[model samples]
Target: MESEPTAELIRAQLRRLRLAANLTQEDFGKQVHFSGSQISAIELGQRPFDRLFLKRADEVLNSDGLLLGLLRIAELHRQPHFLRPWLDAERVAQQLRCYHPTLVPGLLQTEHYARAVIRSDDLLADDEVERRVAVRMDRQAILTRPDNPPILIAVIEEATLRRVDESFRGIMTQQISHLLDCVQRGGVLILVIPAEVSVHVGHAGPFTLACGADGDWVGHLENHLGGATIDRAEELATLHARWDGIRSVALPKGQSELLMKEVMESWSTI
Candidate 1:
């Protein structure tokens, strides 16, 4: 198994490299187009660094992809512990089937929408929220990875598309537009369970099922507290049955896209 590096490890390396280069934090920050205080915060572990920061830092320090490599590994550590196993499965799965009843699936969410979702937890600190959002965005890379990208099939409740948080101005419009673009891009299929269907098995909660190239399967279930990975045969069977039931009521791809466009227009008016 691959090991994950801690934030402290990354911070220490940054400081060591910057010092070895004989540059003050301010000087290094100038080269990276960031303020000295920002560099100080990162080195002191007072703030979390995003991928862009790590990339620029690596280039400036001539680490030859060292920091960038750490960034990828660090993403795993940033995710909630309960979700890591499923995340590993998601990275290697040949196909991913996801169902969400109240919100857009994380794999397909835009950055703005993701930020809102993370921030919805008022108890979380700003840095923690940003870190989680970064992980969510990075997970999306698998969808378009040059290598055999997984075929993603997502089913979302129609209310997810119609609901808009007025506080976030154009968030819904941007999110719906992104979904349409994903549909146009191929290798992805998104269907919607229309609101008219008052009852469904999906109401039990959101779950994801992944199929591996080797004919194995992994399941994931999420609730308010946390999430769990499912590999047990009986549990997998139940999830599979629920998935079929939910997919049965969802609109076909063509109808789904049309409904999404209609919602997008409605959001634009708001």
Candidate 2:
């Protein structure tokens, strides 16, 4: 079997020390040089700790274990290599506030819909597409585990509800069906932003807010042509306020579910 992801092993140790010391992330951040969001990211395995950060954390958390060993592993083995930090954050995020302006989030996609989206990409080979899809499916495990599944609150634009082509439409319909199932299980919140919302907050692109178990929220955006994770409080607070407004303007869940049904019906007609 493959060795455990290096980031995960380090997180396990840091978490043990933090809990032992009874330090909240904010408390810990003050002792270290990181922000609370960055500390949370470290604990979540989304971001690797550089030597300076690790040394500070080791001193602050009063860890006696092998910090260097852990750091070496993280330094050498990280892949998706730029996104480990974001992925780490998602695992421990207890709540998710997300928006998709043009497409469904990967975690919410059906296999067929995911494939169609991949097939349309500019330069991906079939093997690469399959590998990426597999990775996405694996990533969904965090929000699906039995212990503490993350609450997903998503606001999707009305445009995403449209069926662009029949082949993709059937897949999307199934995806809507899956969403309805998730709603039934009480793990998801789906909202549709009206076509005529005069002002919208997520015109930029898809993004999310991830709340760590320590009750800190990390703002998320994958940058243009790449993804970046943001943990600054100033930015997170602004994003939180924007999310509240988006939630307010979006259709109510009941109506949204009904509308989804209607869209699926329309898809059959096309």
Candidate 3:
């Protein structure tokens, strides 16, 4: 059987601790880890901490009861661990910023294009590929949600568009067409980083930012090992600065759309 709900187990335990000790959520997070927002996330069943976080929690909160008693119940639901924070932020963000270097970002990929991209990784078993693809498709619904459907800003490298003539040309065309629709609908902002523009701060890899309704922002950096979610103010500011630099180096939206439309038309030759 699945363990009792992870959120409930954690919230109950944390509430009792705070109440019995007469601590505010702000005080509790300061005692336990980082900030009031973090404690609020824990108490509201919106977040969970890692194992080593226990050691820090113990040291910070002065509670020997256990660092993360909820992990046993929550670990079963974990996948890639790296993506958990992305889901949490994505579901709440008012706007999203993504910079892609090679392939399209997952949020905007069509099923066929996504499948082809995944299949390129020979290490992924058939089942694992399906699971990953399903996870991505599940995220796509956020684009059309009635409330807080995020405004997406995507800055993609021009070289990536060259793959439009690859095996899954139709899918690439559809993805480009989808972008056109999104732009016309005012739901997305697309920019193309031309190969000629040689200078960029994010040249090493891809990153994203999820701006929350409360005005809080978080940054995500993806790597072969997994990904990184940054909530620290200074770090987030640095990421924002870098993204601004990238945008300045990219083509204006109208020009980029025209470029994409022209190339998509060229796909007929493939």
Q: Please name the candidate that would achieve the greatest lDDT relative to the true structure.
A: 1
Candidate 2 lDDT, 1-270, residue by residue in tens: 012576577678888888889998888888886788988987786775655666677787777535645754443343456667777788788988888778888788877778777778879887657646655665677667999799998888777878467557678778888878878888889898867785677776678888888998877686556677888888888888878877888999998988888887788677
Q: Over 4 Å off in model 1, which ranges?
A: 1-27, 34-52, 59-65, 78-80
Expressed as tens digits, the lDDT of each residue in 1-270 for candidate 3 is 112466576567667767777888788777655698887776776775445555565555556745354543354364667778877898788999999788788888887778888888999998667656756676777888987598999998777876654666778788888778878987889999887877678687899999998989998998888888899999999999999998999999889999888877888566
Cand. 2 Cα-lDDT: 0.76
**What clash count does candidate 2 reach?**
6
Question: Could you say which candidate leads in TM-score?
Answer: 1
Off by over 4 Å in 3: 1-78, 164-166
Ten contiguous residues with the weakest lDDT in model 3:
67-76
* lDDT comparison, 1 vs 2, better candidate: 1
lDDT of 1 by residue, 62-140 (tens): 9997877777686676567888889889999899999999989999999999999999999999877877787788899
* Local distance difference test, each candidate: 0.88, 0.76, 0.77
